[model samples]
Target: MTSGLDARIRLSRGPVELEVALTAEAGEIIGILGPNGGGKTTTILALAGVLPLEDGHVAVAGGEWEHAGARRLAPEQRSVGLMLADPLLFPHLTALDNVAYGPRSRGSHRTTARERARTELASVGLTEHLGSRPRQLSSGQAARVALARALATDPDLLLLDEPLAALDPETRARTRSDLAARLAPYEGVTVLVTHDPLDALTLADRLVFIEDGRVTQVGTPTEVLREPRTPYVATVVGLNLYAAQSDSSGTLTLVGGARLVTADSTAGSVWATVSPHSVVLHRERPEGSARNAWPMRVSDVTLQGQSARVSLTGPLDLIAEVTLASVASLTVHVGTDLWASVKATEVFTYPR
Candidate 1:
């Protein structure tokens, strides 16, 4: 069976101590999503062996790579490929030579490596540009060549640190699609560190949420998008979640005293997360089995493609996603008063 990459990195610089654990199965793209200073980059550095560990360990392909308790392996000995935001291509080498450099470094003859490099470059649709130097290629082409070079080593693990961040929006989108297709055939673990939700949603099978130098949640893209943990993650995933407390009998109450019955049976402090898309706006209270309703005035509204994102300020400053058709039907302009209904089950509850 194909193996995976497992890592647990803990370190301290001055008073700040960060510890994070990550695992990516074969052919899986695990996204590490977090804000700046959340220790996302630090974790990647530790995995790559650039940063020393204060504690914990790293294992890739079932082989130990680093640990505070064991002998640390050299970065070159680990079968891992890292692609940063910048391509960092050699100015003197052509795209073909750049892709072949990895295999050549590992003792493959120059001729054999170049032949293999041609195949890898072709996979990224860069075969035609093989003879082009870094300055001669477009930004997207350079990015593709860099990716091909990283893959030429046939590493057991791949690390992508915001690989498309350097490209312009148009180029970024096209390159992102190409990168996704190129990664489909690779039978190794991939760890993608990116902040863009669209990138995470498109490239990752599951997302491991990190914040305050710790992991807050880990789940599939849809799962994490549907159910966010902290208010930070809720805001990141564009959902609204509140700290809720409930009794033993399934009677749920919001922290601010809004009463609602939850389908979930739980006790003590818990979390109630609701997606703005699930919030239905009503001119008056609509008839439904939904158990929660709030009267809110529109604070702001922005058109988002075929849908409109409405910001409501009332008991909670929440954003609701509604279709453009509903916008004309409801006439939901600023200062408009409408009822917002959310189902009990739709308001997912989880332990705090």
Candidate 2:
């Protein structure tokens, strides 16, 4: 496959500093997931030529936009389309005119631009609202129009920064589906920046994790879900993560001086991971073959779908996910005493 967008850049502005190397093939969508102030938006701005890189290069469709410290293209000179969290539509223009503006700005004939706009709006399921103004349309409808405007210019790359962040849950779902369908037939590289795990997992071909202005991890969605390298990724993927030191004898020592015996042995510093569901809670110490067990007090309980995630702190701080039925049977509540146990086989240890 041909490369559509390739960038390796470094930028330092006041308190924010970012270094990222990203590459995506034609028709590939790369989702950038991270916490707030993680430089996700800055990376997108650099790609779109809105922010200049202190060093490195950016190339789209084999054409260099910025290279070394000498050559740099203006934002208007790049063949990039950007859709931000806000639709930012022109309040005075109708939806059709707004969609047509991109092509018209590029010197297309007036008739040709309107025809292109009509086609793009239809593709995004906004054909019926073509004459509506920005304020007259619903949030979801405005988002679709914004998407249509972005694609009208036949951009070689698309940058979406939290495109569905403003919509309500139901509207967000419908708009997300529409966005996915509109992107399927596009033969350009796409970069989506979002904090939502569902958006990244469902719409992206690969995922990139950024933390503290640096790229921390990069992999396909399935690969990332199987093994997350950072605490943020672990939390986003709903796994219990602990940083510990492991000896060759399979004893893992946590930062708080708690120890866990694992089936797999490793040396030096390692990261241990276990699913919350794997933790078995008891009202009192129970006789079991499990290698790891500790008396803990329930710290908090949060409902997640049909299960409740119970936070326990005692010998080791951990999260245990149990069904509602189990919560009731165990009388789980904050400040309640309980025993937590996990089999050695369930604890996965890897070198940090």
Residue 62 accuracy (lDDT) in model 2? 84
Question: lDDT by residue for model 2 over 1-352, one digit each (tens)?
Answer: 2368889979985677899999999999999999889899999989988889999899999888998688999999899888988999999999999999999999999899999999999999888998999999999999999999999999999999999999999999999999999999999999999999999999999999999889999999998888889989998888988899998988999988999989987788998999998999998887878999999999999998899999999988899999999999999999999999999999998878
Reference-based TM-score of each model: 0.85, 0.93
The residue pairs found clashing in candidate 2 are: none
Ten consecutive residues with minimal summed lDDT in candidate 2? 1-10
As for candidate 1, its clashing pairs are: none
TM-score of 2: 0.93
For 1-352, candidate 1 gives per-residue lDDT tens digits of: 1268878889975545687888878889999989888888888888888888989888888788887967798778878788989999999999999999999988999999999999999999987898999999999999999899999999988889989999999999999999999999998888899988889989999998888788988999888877787777787788888887888766677777776667788788888777888888999977888787888899999997899999987766668999999989999999999988888787667788
The predictions' CA RMSDs to the true structure, in order, are 3.3, 2.1
Runs of candidate 2 with Cα error greater than 4 angstroms are: 247-249, 265-269
Q: Cα deviation in Å at residue 243, candidate 2?
A: 2.9
